[model samples]
Target chain A: MNGDLTVSAASKDTLPTVFGYIGIGVAFGIVGKAAGLSPLLVTLMSIITYAGSAQFVIVSMLVTHSPIFSIIFSVFLVNSRMILMSTTLASYFKRESMVKNILVGTLLTDESFALGMNKLNYSDNHLNFAWFNTANVISYMTWILSSLVGAVLGNFISNPEKFGLDFALVAMFIGLLYLQLISDKSINFNLQLIVVGFVLVAIYFGLIFIPSSLLILLVTLVACSFGVVMKHAFF
Target chain B: MPSFNFVLLTIVGTGVVTWLSRITPFVLLKKFQLSKGVVEFLSFVPIAIMSALWFENLFVQHIGHLPSIDWANLLASLPTVLSAVISKNLLVIVVVGVISLGVTRLMMGM
Candidate 1:
């Protein structure tokens, strides 16, 4: 397939994700601001990271005064799934030029990858460079703009707690996790999630004796192994 | 606020690391050809990671002490999970979360 820009239904499909990005991005920005990061830095973080859960976790770590190494390590761990997404997306790129592939890869986010991949399996016409890039660009801009607004708005929020800004991150995570669990319809998949969920909380109980920085990473790996094991056993 | 330099460094550090995770396979891999076992293992990573993140946020992890649940977050999660189930939409779930937490704290007077 030739790689000229095509723009048919892409814009229409991107509208819903734009709304999601704006909402969550604003939540992240306000939380970042309340954690004492500047509006510019919050917006910059959005531009650079383009990840929802990772940025929120980073803000929480920053609030706790986590070391730089720990923070960087968390970013990698939190985003390790991106590697899989990139590899899967690469399969769809076929013979596309390196420039197109690299640029697309750099802009990949959970939403962009899911949306683009959703279309690719349905129709070859749905995933040209133009359609995919339009979706990514739209989401990227909405996220950054919303973050900037949220951070600026955060300055006026003398009491972030009363407004429930502190709980937003927790809520966001739960929302995302629940969404991930339900996205697949298989009962075994749900059971896998439940297995991982139990493993996670059970290991997190060790936080009393172990530092969370270590526990978080360890718990994620162990829980995933458990999930994979259950996948073999049940499915 | 953190020092400008520290903030800048964090931005750059996370950016580079995260960017690498996103771009490396695109540059190197020609296809998604991981072994079945590897793919299955990788598939579980998000479930593991996201659940851990959710649990951590819902509970206050105290060093040298057992974790305590954040009542506000715990309270908000009921409605948030419901919204996720009903709408399967991020925007709806998040909006429900913010409002639920705000209402819970208002009632608790915390």
Candidate 2:
């Protein structure tokens, strides 16, 4: 080995993710702490679950005293996209050992997976487990630390809602929803918006008619089907 | 403080389910193939879920009555959605949304 430090392409694109995770992580922490969770629990969530939106949903659910099974279902639904990511990654990991696949899979995230896939498709980066895991670990540690910072910061705020900390989750979702809309270049902007508008209206009515715990899952399923059907019908 | 067990279970349970979903495709889906239709449908899940979550929190619902907008959040959403569109950055959008909401709440004498 030359002993010269070389930044793997897998890790190079992680700078944006570092900043992204910290902001979201801290927001999650403040929101969690605002909901009466211990700072330690907030940090543990960052360390363990590591999914941003899902964590927010879980915290809000906990505040409402939702059933435990319902909370788990929310996690599963929010994170089901990981299945698609893992499926795409499986092709790349075929030659690697099962142990490596297992370990790497555990660390898979939207940013890291996107980085690895983008590099594989266009760049010359050698995506070894070391490089891949390095990306995940960096964000992983950053998330936990940022969440702790927010949790500690949250202690000083007498009323989170007054400070708009409660709106943080909703704001984050709005941002994320926009991100999702643009992330997939395959789908045109207009079409995605139509679907979003449809889903929003459905959820509004669904909230009134159906049990929310059940409505969320059903709406997601129905909306996706509607999107697929519309996509085929249009394009 | 919430019951220690409930908090622990939620965290651990979510972590398990999340990790399992991340790894399941590697160990199990390797042998099978997902149809293109299924993948397309899956792509829409995030959009649908995010929209649902956003709308759910944006309004205050009443049984047998249409949900009314939470004016504070709705007003705050003006800037939030704008920053999200203009900057297209999560951190920026969040900062804008938080500051805007905080200001709105203050000005409204909330």
Candidate 3:
């Protein structure tokens, strides 16, 4: 009975994550259509890029007819943080099969990482790889299918922008940020200061720059370093 | 319009590079154990990157100008932040945020 309860609870926990992905996926698809990408291309992007910020950057760049080099460089800059996410997650996935690890890693977005990390803490199972893959695959499929739907129906939507679909990504990030910031009791002040400082710097540089991607990258790295140093020196 | 070959290559390149970034850390850490200090440092990277991205979007402008604090955006952002804090659900937060933005825009006659 205890084992069955645990199984049920585990399944229940995972269901919300899948449902959350579906909702975000639909929003992403609608945003993709508004951004003027074709349904097939958006579907491909949802499957291939999978990173929401990078996809937004890609679409924005495509709309502007930016050079190929700029597009690639911007994607690289925006995604550099994934290096950190992947590195931290490595400890949890060290023992998985190579093929499984690769497949799972490909789907390790911020949402999946948060969900998988929570499940990891509660369960002592060795099927970490499976759980991670399940979350990723479900999220990936949701994104692709919904993007296709949005693309096809995009024409009839008239002005989806009127719905403020663009802010969907921002809302998702802010929600995640709120959760993380609220949970950390000690360093909330420092985190806010760092965020504000970065925002100011991004604004300053943005005023002078044509493509703000590189400037944002520089300000972020500097702010991160400053925060780390401050945490060590004072806190 | 971008040629089909160009689109294909872009997709392939993005997939290949993204996969490489995801896999490298896992492979390296597994084959050779990472230090505790390194892991601890890495834990903060996501927040750092996320902050940078979020901050940039809120302030950066397309025409090499400062992002004007359009009242509609600010009003919409307020409710969005509130929903995010109270709901703790991604879907609810996004839905409320989008709706708020739309309603605020209409109210502002923008």
Best by lDDT: 2
lDDT of each: 0.71, 0.75, 0.63
Which candidate tops DockQ? 1
Better of 1 and 3 by TM-score: 3
- Summing lDDT over every window of 10 consecutive residues in candidate 2 chain B, give the lowest-scoring window: B41-50
Once fitted onto the true fold, the runs of candidate 3 whose alpha carbons sit more than 4 angstroms away are: A1-38, A59-70, A114-127, A184-210, A215-217, B62-67
TM-score head-to-head 1 vs 2, winner: 1
Q: After superposition, how far is residue A116 of candidate 2 from its true place, in Å?
A: 9.2
Docking class of 3: medium
Ranking by TM-score: 3, 1, 2
Clashing pairs in 2: none
The residue pairs found clashing in candidate 1 are: none
Report fnat in order of the candidates. 0.67, 0.73, 0.46
Compose the digit string of candidate 2's lDDT tens values, residues B29-96.
Answer: 55677677776776666567667767777778777778878788889989999998899776677778
| DockQ scores of the candidates | 0.53, 0.52, 0.49
Candidate 1 per-residue lDDT, tens place, A1-235, comes to 1223356466666665665566667777778888889898998899887777689888888778788888899888777767766775675575788888888888888767655644543464345677777877887888899899889988775454576655555555565566556554433666765766675566567667765555655776676677776767776
What TM-score would chain A of each candidate receive against the reference chain A? 0.68, 0.67, 0.71
List per-model TM-scores for chain B.
0.74, 0.72, 0.73
What is residue B88's positional error in candidate 3, in angstroms? 3.9
Q: Please tell me what DockQ candidate 1 reaches.
A: 0.53
